[model samples]
Target: MLWGKNIYRLSCISSGMSLFSNLMYISFIYSISAKNSDSDAQGLVHPIRDPRLLSGVRPGITSSQGTSLQGSYYLRNSYLRHNLKENQTGVPLFLTISVTDTNSCSPIENALVELWGANNHGLYSGFSKSGSPSSDCSSWLRGAMETDSEGLAKFETLYPGQEENRSLHLYAIIRTDWYEHSKNQTVDSDSSHNAAAIVQIFFPDSLNHQVLNRTDYKITGRQFVKNKQDFIFSSGQGVLKAKAELPKSSICGGVQAHVQISVDAHASQNITVTESPYQCKTNCKAYQNTTEQTTTISATSKHKPHFIPLAVIFFASTYVFYG
Candidate 1:
């Protein structure tokens, strides 16, 4: 009777231990998956009080011309302009924008997506302070395109250079309706009714450091602003940032960024264009002036740790206790 009781007690203890170990392993897996889902999931709404919008230039009446001098305004109605890689001075950037409706979380088709940013020297195409014509006549780094059925708008352009107070960024505007711009109207005009969302796109600081170190960017001698230091970026949280995948080989020399923007298509959020800290200064003549070194970063591999060790340990402990 005593030996039989010992066997029964051992069986119960082993069952309990097995159950506890299984629960612990399941909890660990759940926590990791939840964290990853939060990072990869889309649908975060971008804030409207973007300080960078203050420099938003109105699209010129013609595709070839830049913004008007009346004041800076967001570009619209420049659909004819595509492929913003005309000047191609810096590292190539392949940008893809995915537009989704905040209400239904469905992809929005035919949304007008306008993108504008600075060149290798940190100069905007239209604004004179950024090295464009005084009349704001050059439109090299600005273009507009409509989202396709999948709500994707792709742009082939150079990686944006940094400004004094601003990190490397690209400005984007999504509109559902087409509104005609008055000849004298500025971006400050009440055009929010038609605008779905006005936001800025950002890159990772690690990638920025790598790209800026290249000869094309190093010649500018301008200090780059990190995303953490930029008020506009910090204010938007992580919603406005794009996920960049750097090129692994010299043959594929450009980087690709993907971002999904969620907006209320029917509702108009007030997007006021206020003055920004970004100045219209030319690039600093200072240059790091080093031989361009190519550094390749391999894509991060996702290898799950082997869980067999845990099972083996559990079995060994069971055997020791039972024996």
Candidate 2:
């Protein structure tokens, strides 16, 4: 259910409203702004609720390194990065991308996008695993946005830090549609599910590179280049491209990188899927109609105000328990 050089951000929810089931209601939120030409959101599973499993293997890439990043100068974070627990409103570094369909290259407007990233300290906001308190907003670094006709999605946040040599990276999830030609095809097919791809955005000339020596890491910005020449973008080109432009300090305060993502037209608005439910399948490879039945009893000579009776019954039950 995954492939290619995509800024991947997948989430899988189970049935109902259980703690894990929240993913089911996520359908309304499946949209994203892609940075490359190949951004998409077509998964084999009709309702992909298990993100970790359906998200494919975490590519064989080295982790993020922080040495080269320490000595580097981040104008925006010059005063914001160190022990930021005291600060309330962190500078918002806007991360925006436009997503498109690969086959037709048209912008898939109104597509849902969700993103999650670490803070300047390489720690996720509002999480204990990244050294931030559970009540902190760091975990909230993740965000969601719908694409415009131009297939653009944007977010305002801060530059993530390089902690414990863990590389700074961003994860994204985009939702689109499948082309009719791809209907009935297996999820394993490369072109079968084309709406979504796992992509990695790296700091091309990051100061951390020099301080961390992450050149050996697989997911490092260095690995993004195939021949150590190209920006290491994946085959078929990405819909968006990102850059860091930290402005001058003083009247401008600290420097901040401007990440601009230009979407590719070829990869947008084309629904590519084999044997979709809307098409009415008879001999489709991936077909399943899950339904459940429940029975209910109604009171005869029904009275009005059902809530009053229910409240009385609840009060009686509570009284019995306490008495």
User: Best TM-score goes to which candidate?
Assistant: 1
lDDT (tens digit, per residue) of candidate 1 on 263-293 = 6666543343332223222331110111111
Cα misplacement distance, residue 81 of candidate 2 (Å): 24
User: Each candidate's TM vs. the true structure?
Assistant: 0.55, 0.37
Model 2 lDDT tens row, 164-210: 43344454434343111123221222322332433445554453343
Instruction: Please give the clash total of every predicted structure, in order.
Output: 3, 84
List the lowest-lDDT window of 10 residues for candidate 2: 73-82
Please list the residue runs of candidate 1 whose C-alpha ends up more than 4 Å from where it truly belongs after superposition.
1-79, 129-133, 179-194, 219-221, 237-239, 272-323
Error of 2 at 137 (Å): 9.0
Q: lDDT (CA) for every model shown?
A: 0.57, 0.35
* Model 2 ranges off by over 4 Å: 1-91, 129-138, 177-195, 206-241, 250-323
